[model samples]
Target chain A: MSFLSINSIAHIISAIIGTGAATAEEILYFKDIRDGKIDEAEARHLRITYKIMHWSLIILVLTGFGILAGVRIKYGGTKTFYSPVLWAKYTIVLVLLANAVLIAARKMPMKWAGSLSLTSWYAAFALGRITEKTREIKWLADFLSKFNFVELYLITMVCYILAVAIVAIILNYLKKIIIKKQ
Target chain B: MSVLLQFSLISHIFLGLLGIILFYAVLMVLFKPIDFKRIKFLRRVSLLGLISFLSSWILGGYYYVVYYGNIVKPLIKKSAYPWAHSIFMEAKEHIFLFLPFAALVAVLIFYILGEELEQKQAIKKTVIILSSLIVILGAIMALTGIIISGAARLR
Candidate 1:
């Protein structure tokens, strides 16, 4: 395969790993906290998933940039590099990186961070998969392309904030359910 | 584009990326308590990040002066969204100058202060802010470059 193809495969693999890790982390978090506290096993499981998330992120960035460099070499900066959807995805990745920093600093609330982490990862994953060429979403292509970079960014962030709120509510509800069961 | 121009363009991007990654490393290191043992290592990384930014500045400046102004500039200007050049590139080039200067100051703070920085909470905070500033500015420059390039291609 060509250099681009190899990098593309690596990028997709990393994305899958990242998305899966993020999902597992959330699910495990809820399960581990069912008793209102974390045991050693729960802590270990959470740590392992976090490590997976971090590793997958590093791989995703390396492969993603490699793919960009390859595209730049062959095609210069085409729409593929700067489309609204792509830019939205790029900003979401930035948010993810920034969120990780906040997490490391122990600055953000765990609830907010957890919600942001889960939502941003899924948003980035969904944006990567859906494109203008997909026959089912062909109309989405024409529809989304109308918005500029700033609009898409605002839309993504608004949606992101809303998702965080919604997820937080669900988590709280789940916590009550668990507490009542106990 | 000629082979030389392509090389310059790619090198410029690679260096910019290197600079961003290094500062990110610096921030990650600083996110924890200041390690007296890692002070020297911290300075080294900060210095390298500064050099990367300055080097990228020179390389990107060469690309802009030699080829971009004469050819790519006009193509982008005449494109459907001339604002990509008129605004994004215009603002980006000016704003990019801030990055190397900030990185240099950050390097100097770490180098000259050494472990002394650990004692001064305010100074440590400033250094962290500077590193964060560099990362944010670098991301903006990269994204703006993408916009400018896309405009040139479509036109």
Candidate 2:
């Protein structure tokens, strides 16, 4: 397979594994805490899950940008740095990822972790959708057509991060019911 | 934006957010070692979240078909990438997709695996792990979708 194919497959596989780790960790984290072993398991699980997530993130950024650049070259166009969508998307991803690191690394409180994780995930999805849809639009097609893959990847992450923060705020406000329950 | 776009976007955003919230909630409860005091509340919250997330996904999918069929279809008759599309979107149409399946399995596995262990602790641990995976997978899907779509520019 070509580089793109390989990258895609790798991303998928990594996602599966990374998610599995995350899933396992989340469950175990709660278990450990209840068992009064949160301290012991927290570091190990955090390190492993963080590493997996970080590497998967690296693959995501690399491949994401590569795809953008490849597309621009294929379409014989170039997206400029001033692109609003691009800038927005990148900013969002940055915020989301930063929060994720803080939470996963245990810098943030558990309450914040829940809120932050929710924010980051939503933001990523929002920005991703925006970027994808914009590209599909004829008017947007030409404008976003520029930039190397790396550049686009950067922009996409930014958007993802910002989107998460925005959504998180809303969810947090509505968290009254959940907070009460817990 | 137009009505369809607005409708689609709203649902998309809602479901997306719902999924994230539910995924995290599950993790927090599961990872924290099921306090009997928190069990009823956490389970209730999780169930609600699951309902909200699923509803969002359903609405989001509806919007995808309607909007894409109307807008993106002319450019690319079928999905530009059939294999990826099938795994992520098409297969998801029937539910029991990778994510929900993984989630279900996590729930079942947690119940089975931790049944004999400390009730609250095992349950919490199992839920957290499962939910965390689902959340991460969701993130990957979102990121990869963009990358893949952008890459299609190459084809």
Candidate 3:
């Protein structure tokens, strides 16, 4: 395989693992906390998933740099590096890293951070798959380019909050029903 | 690009990335309650961050002085994305100068406080804010670097 292909495969695999771990972490956190607490076993499971996520992140970062370096040498200044979509992905990745730290330190209102963590991984994954030439996604790059980082962050904040709220509310109702039956 | 210029540019960026990581480590340490173990850890990481920032400054400054102005700057200015240099690079060069100083202050704070930094809630909060800014500024600089390179390459 070409070096770029190898690097791309590694990057994509790690991204999938990280995103999956984040999704599972969210579900486990919500369910475990429904009773207002998490047992040692439940917390340990969450920790394990978090560790998995971290390991994936490390691999993703290394392989990502490899791909970027390879592209830089071969493409001789393609717009890929300058794309707004790519930078947006970079921003989301930064948010994910910072959010993980906040969650670990137990600082800040975790609801926003937790919801962001869940939504951002999916957002990043989507962003990665959608390129400037991506047929249906052609408009998205231009649309995303319209705003600066601060504005984009505000938009992401509103979207994630709304999305997580809808899900959390439904989960709350389901848990109530389940408890009533028990 | 000459081999020297390329090496300097890569070294500058790599050091900057390392500095950002170390700044994140410092911020993570500050997020928790201060303690003896944490204080020791903070000292080590902050000092490393300080070194990283200082080293990046020297290397990047060398490139800016010796190579960027002569060759890269003109290319970026004439390129289609002049804003990459005019706006992003303009902001980045100035903002980057702040990092090493900020990191130095953090090192001093850690040096002076030792374990006593735990009791000084106000001081601790100040460090937290400082570290947070460093991380954000570093991230901005990284983004700006991308634009600068992209613009330079456009020619």
Candidate 4:
């Protein structure tokens, strides 16, 4: 197996584990709230979810940069930063990461989980479509093609990160709504 | 394109759209308080999700044979995307296969078992397993695409 394979497989496993842990925590938390056993539920699940999301974000960034670094060495690539798609992706990821931190701090709005999830998924889907289009266009033998697949992938990942942040905001909002109603 | 490939592409796009819709519906249920009415909505959404998920993969398989198997498969050894490497490509293949199985498990758990947080231990476990699988599988698929594209640059 190449070093790329080793790194990718490790990243894949971590992503799966992180998502699984977060999902489990959310399900259990929701169940506890639904059963009016909120107090009975361990408070640790929220912390665990926070930790999972944080570490996953770290892994995602690290792997992304690692891939870029590896490519730089192999291709004798010049560093250029004039990619719109990459910029878009970076902005989205940064915003999303900030939201996740807020969620971990219990400072985000919870009432919007439904909307947040919907929007997040929509953003992710759009990002995927755009990523595909970018690749197709970038590979076009045009003299000044700007939409490379790697850039597109970066944008897509950033979109996903943003979506995650939206979820965190929505979760916070939902919690508030439920609390107020009670 | 061959008939199989054409069918596969259409099916894949259709299923992807349907899955996205169902994903939103599921989110609504999770975020909002569940009432009887919401449960009914959930049932409808889950069933629809199952159909679309199945269709997407059936088409995806066809696409795999036509596009990857015949054309890109042979050329990959020589191709390299900017961030791509050969091993990354192989791992992508593994993820593409495994993620679908994980999705299948999630669909079965959520739709077939009709167990979405009834609060019983078994039901809870089933729902957890289903949701967790979906989340994890989705993440894996996304990551695989990124790495594979990156690795392709090496060729």
**Candidate 4 residue-wise lDDT, B8-105, digit = tens:** 64456446445634643464354444456766676677667667666776776777766756654554455544333355545655654554454456
- Better TM-score candidate (2, 3): 3
User: Least lDDT summed over 10 consecutive residues: which range in candidate 3 chain A?
Assistant: A69-78
Using lDDT as the measure, the top candidate is 1
Whole-model alpha-carbon lDDT for candidate 1:
0.82
Per-residue lDDT of candidate 1, residues A13-45 (tens digit): 988998899999988987877788899989999
User: Which tens-of-lDDT digit does each residue in A71-172 have in candidate 2?
Assistant: 333352233223455545545455555566456436676656644554444444455555657767877666666765567667666655465457546555
| TM-score of chain A, cand. 2 | 0.54
State the DockQ of every prediction. Answer: 0.40, 0.03, 0.30, 0.03
Please give, for residues A1-182, the per-residue lDDT of candidate 3 as tens digits: 96568889999999999999988987788678767668999999998988888778756755665576556544545677666567667777887887777776777475466667777788788777875245366577567678875676577656655765776566556656655654
Worst 10-residue lDDT window, candidate 1 chain A:
A130-139
Which of the CAPRI classes, incorrect, acceptable, medium or high, describes model 4?
Answer: incorrect
DockQ of predicted model 4: 0.03
Interface RMSD of each: 2.6, 9.7, 2.9, 11.5
Candidate 1 CAPRI-style tier: acceptable
TM-score of each model, in listed order: 0.85, 0.43, 0.81, 0.44
Off by over 4 Å in 4: A1-182, B1-7, B82-85, B96-116, B121-129, B146-155
Each model's lDDT comes to 0.82, 0.52, 0.77, 0.51
Judging by DockQ, tell me the better candidate of 3 and 4: 3
User: Which candidate number maximizes TM-score?
Assistant: 1
What lDDT is obtained when candidate 2 is compared to the true structure?
Answer: 0.52
